[model samples]
Target: MENTSTRSTSRPSATRVFVARLVGTGVFDPLGDAVGKVHDVVVLLAHRGQPRAVGLVIEVAGRRRVFLPLSRVTAINPGQVITTGLVNIRRFEQRAVETLVFSELLDRVVTMRDGSGQVSVRDVAIEKDRNRDWKVTRLFVQRASSGPLGLRRGETFIVRPDDVTGLAGSLGPQSAAALLATMEDLKPADLAGVLADLPLARQVEVAAELEDARLADVVEELSDDEAVALISALDAARAADVLDAMQPDDAADLVAELPTAKADVLLDLMQPDEAEDVRRLLTYDGYTAGGLMTTEPIILPPEATVATFLAQARKAETAPALAAVAFVCRPPLETPAGRFLGMVHLQRALRERPQQPLGSILDKDLDVVLPDDSIGTVTRLLATYNLTALPVQDEAGRLLGAVSVDDVLDHLMPDDWREADDAVTDEMIERSANA
Candidate 1:
């Protein structure tokens, strides 16, 4: 492969070569003394709103890896990196703001428009931006390396970063707002991760472009801070619409995380029923049953048939998670849920005739809790019985809503779990009726 740039800054030429060629190239001082061999290049993301090379890791002796700051670098080409010989002897530690191209980026699948079509990164091409700062401008994509085909026509084109999209459904930086109009059926948390990876400007653009309902789903997967940041970017009406689209429990959590004035405005903008649901949940302690339980679950009347249960389960497929059990309750479906009949495990509905009523199929040994029940009690109830969901009742034994295990996990896991690299996927959601 050909490459460009030269030892003299004023001298320019057309040269092109893969970045990997620089991996083991020898580094030298201005006097031509050998400083070391190139180990890796360090890039600071969003440096000037684009990833830019900031430093390099060079091996001085057999064991010592020294940092060669970018300011000391004079030239970079296909197989060689020239430095001013000055180096920091300290060992390299990747800062949160920095990433090693050869380590964090290589081989990761990047996509366009969410996860629609993807390209595997063989190498990233760094070029001098208009400011003369080294910025990652293109990717050497391995088009069809995984398939039986060796390499196709479009297999090795070098395209700018914006041309690529998601990494396992993540949104890459510089993705067009139009491409994001279609979010491709992705898990909310996965979509959130992609959103988190985008630059703030593009993220806001996508925010304005996304449907309120879809935005709500993706927002539910983000941290309260990130969710608030994105929501604040939209018009007040759109923000309220997004909050309304989210489940009442998750909506309440996101709202609670916002400023009082912002939350109040959103609540005021929401429909009375939806606003009231979130307000009620907000009043409860986040770690308590009232907080852990969703205001909406599969609630049914005793007279509701098995067919009705199946239909509800099917509708819940569109939701982030489904209630594993259906609570048979009286009218008002609210906190003082009127009279509570027992619950019917959704699994039992499959065994019985669709035409049959649910009353006869209720679990005889039901363990229920009040909204004020401690989180420990709720966790024990869910774990001990291997129950996928537990009913939350009020003082009157009225069924309010069900406490799903996913909610329990949400309350119990680390604060940053939604952004965790191995985020909990929609397996919990997919098993809408799983026990």
Candidate 2:
């Protein structure tokens, strides 16, 4: 009766927290005095599950850092981060960072069971059933790193994902932190093959998901023909987006291969100058120097310094289309016919004496091809000089573009047509499905 007449006992809902507010917060000492700032929060999550923070990363001095458990957080507000536990900063710094369990570090470098070697994991194969939770079925070791661990030994170490200790059933700070930092090192060619094998939809999704810089690197690795085919397969809008993300010259080259109507639609979607440059290339015969060359060449005045070149390189928003060599041009827009000078190979530009004038190092005998030169002729020039690239000029000796060795190779030996036949099988399957 006495209790019934009194106030009811109930717990209030906990306050919610947002990531933006948590990112940069001031940590305070037990006395409520400001001490440090939180640098990052470590979160852990279940496989393909939501992320949740469990620990705080605090930076004390310029270099000193420590981890604090979320359980110690007393209050979290826009203005400050308060903790209830009193801990010495020096002691926290001295504490060893916890070692993640072998299973928790899947897809990371880990020692083999034999203790004979190390291997990097590729992926974690998992199993799931309607009635049961998904569990890790096996660990997939990269083929290159599986040699030392015999097949039998590798099979024995595969752990169930659900059974993984230290990392499973948690979507806290540590897991989120680990996931963000995790990266796979893949060769460009290998990555390209993997992307190519994915379903068309998935391929586009993956391409769209990648950061621009990484996408640029992947594009640089693809053969010109492969790049053209990939771009052409995408819908006009998406293809244009990828092209716009690419170097101006690369964008132009791919656009040049498209059918006129489609090409125009894509170009209209691109930036004005880029569209104009690509249109200029489109006017040339596909096999000619003008067609093969990129207009976005790196050009510098003869007086520009190596330091200046490096600075320009750092500031450049995109890689130059034809940067294998940097041309040193004369002032007042003098044509080579007026007073011919030399070209500066990029390697020479980087290593040449800083004080030496660029004119002194010009390769005056640099081979030049006319815009109308045949692909066969270009191939010969490439083989005869072992040149990686050659400049293209008009009859008046005005620079128009430059052709790369890779382009010449594409014009010579094309990719085996067998793969195209396989692609036909896939098309047949899709048609059958539709029917």
Candidate 3:
């Protein structure tokens, strides 16, 4: 059969509008093969704010509800609506539902709160406007307070639609549909944050709707434990792809947190170097500097001049942690020959004399640490010196890695660490079980 999925970019014509209006009142012919009665017209709004009839919700024999998009509509008359193709209700039901209208979401637990206060939403405010258009105008909340009658009137709060903490736009049926359709357009970080607040089932549902790259970003932003949990919920192939897209250190951490058999399966699917880095980090104690540091940073030779360092830095594809500070070290910071000479802040490197030897301009007296240092020691050093990051070195003073303020915060908070622990745990279990 010829495909009837219409892909139109233009607004619905006058005739289309008239037909849409008659949707609930008219009978529908399934291209002369079957018949049904229209129950509703699912309107999809264009970017320009024009409402277009995108689909028809019809009630079939025995009270079965079926939806038919405009593309499937072959004809429409005063008495009857004609569909050009057949639709399997079971298949339609199986397809993920997207863009739920505010009306439909009403009475459902939604995240909202009074202005500047804690988040709390007891009920959604449904207002009938002058035009009789029903809209979710505000969120109602209950608080504690005293009343004028010498009796306490339960404290109640209202949150205007404008004050919504989440994504904005209309919460009408059509708008809800549009939100669902364009959900993938949002950045993963944004989507992840929103999803993070949702229940696990809902998170999985929304995650399945996202593309691989976007899903990867969501996973990357999640706490290490959360990422591992989410990935474990996904199919092995999809989970592996997300891990592969993350930074090597992050990927390793997450992999370590997973169950051994699964982690091994995922590792076997990943590239060798990435799997190795994650495996290495898995060996470290969770509370140590080594556990918090990322291996991907910019390293500079002690002999390199400020000018050269600037040039190299400009060209180097370093992570954000490395980009903030230029570390100057002699030979191997991990070996006896290596020494932590000094460091150059990016701002200083840009403004200072270009011809000056890096050693002369470098902050010779630098705060450094051994890999085995406790989280408490690292946190204290960072707080005392007010440093953005501190270099971690071996006993010989070779730069093994550097930990950022974020890493320290993660160590302290524990909740902020993403994806690394699970990956390590998985690998360890796998190795031990195999042995």
The models' CA-based lDDT, in order, is 0.70, 0.54, 0.57
What lDDT, from 0 to 1, does candidate 2 have? 0.54
Task: Report each candidate's C-alpha RMSD, comma-separated, in the order given.
Answer: 13.3, 21.5, 22.0
TM-score of each: 0.60, 0.50, 0.51
Ranking by lDDT: 1, 3, 2
The candidate with the higher lDDT, 1 or 2, is: 1
| Candidate 1 clash pair list | 2-16, 2-17, 3-15, 3-16, 111-165, 111-166, 170-194, 171-194
lDDT of 2 at 2: 12
Cα lDDT tens digits for candidate 2, 150-236:
533333233223333334322221211222223236655545644443334444545665655555556655656667666766667
Q: Where does model 2 exceed 4 Å of error?
A: 1-184, 219-238, 247-249, 257-259, 310-324, 331-340, 417-435
Poorest lDDT segment (10 consecutive residues) of candidate 2: 171-180
lDDT of 3: 0.57
Deviation in angstroms for 249 in model 1? 1.0
lDDT of 1 by residue, 1-435 (tens): 111222234332243224555666888888888888876678766523556777777766533556788678888755567877678877666677776665446555676432335666667666665565676766666554333434343455555666666532324433233234234566666567657654455576667667777778888888778887887777789889888999888998988888899889999999998999999999999999998778778888888899998888887333434545777887765555768888887778999999899888888586769898998899898889888878888777777777888888877666655532232334433343253
